[model samples]
Target: MGLISEVLLLPLAPVRGSAWAIRQALREAERLYYDPAAVRTELARLEEQLEAGEITEEEFDQREDELLDRLEEALRRRGATGEGTAL
Candidate 1:
């Protein structure tokens, strides 16, 4: 039965493989996006941009808020998953 089912499903292998690859890529992207260190680095860069007058105070405030939200979320996720103790 197992052999028969596998043979029947063989034609869908490419679709399954593609779906799996897409899921893996999305997971990796999410991990990077939520990484605490990367978020901090981005926050620092945003501050520098403000100091350089590349961005207005309003823009800095908005971006800083977004980065803080990301950092908070990352810490929350880490706590939930017991992945690490540090943010």
Candidate 2:
């Protein structure tokens, strides 16, 4: 941008910086959401909850399906990007 543009936009620098920080945080959150290891840990926790009588069989099945779906998605994403561990 030209010097005049930069000078005019200087007042919005903090807003720009805040937006960048929010984007970065969301990116990391999404990475973790699609992480295979994290999904596995969640699966284990769900099993424990079921065994401990904290959840019903129906609930367990539903949540298990969701977790497995996430695992599949994570695996697919990994395969597509050729990054991270595979299922």
Candidate 3:
């Protein structure tokens, strides 16, 4: 950008910096969310929660299905990227 444009945008620098930080945080969050190990840990936690009566059967079933789907997707991603051992 030209000097004039940079000067004009100086006032918004903080806002732009905040937006960049948020995007970075989201990227990291998604990476962890799709990690195979993280998914497995979540699955175990969900099972434990169900056994503890912390969640109803319907809720458990729904969450379990979602987690299983994530697991499958994570495995597929691992195979495509060669980042982790496929399940």
* The best candidate in terms of TM-score: 1
Q: How many clashing residue pairs, candidate 2?
A: 0
Residue clash pairs of candidate 2: none
Candidate 3, 1-87: lDDT as tens digits: 999999999999999999999999998988898888888999999999999999999999999999999988888888888786745
**Candidate 1 clashing pairs, residues 3+ apart or interchain:** none
TM-score for each of the candidates: 0.94, 0.89, 0.71
Task: Evaluate residue 43 in candidate 2 and report its C-alpha lDDT on the 0 to 100 scale.
Answer: 99
Clashing pairs counted in every model: 0, 0, 0
Ten residues in sequence with the least summed lDDT for candidate 3: 78-87
**Overall lDDT per candidate, in order of appearance:** 0.94, 0.94, 0.91
Q: Could you tell me how far off, in angstroms, the CA of residue 72 lies in candidate 1 after the best superposition?
A: 0.7
Tell how far residue 16 is off in model 3, in angstroms: 0.7
Q: For candidate 2, write residues 1-87 as lDDT tens digits.
A: 999999999999999999999999999998999999999999999999999999999999999999999999999888889786544
Looking at model 3, the pairs that clash are: none
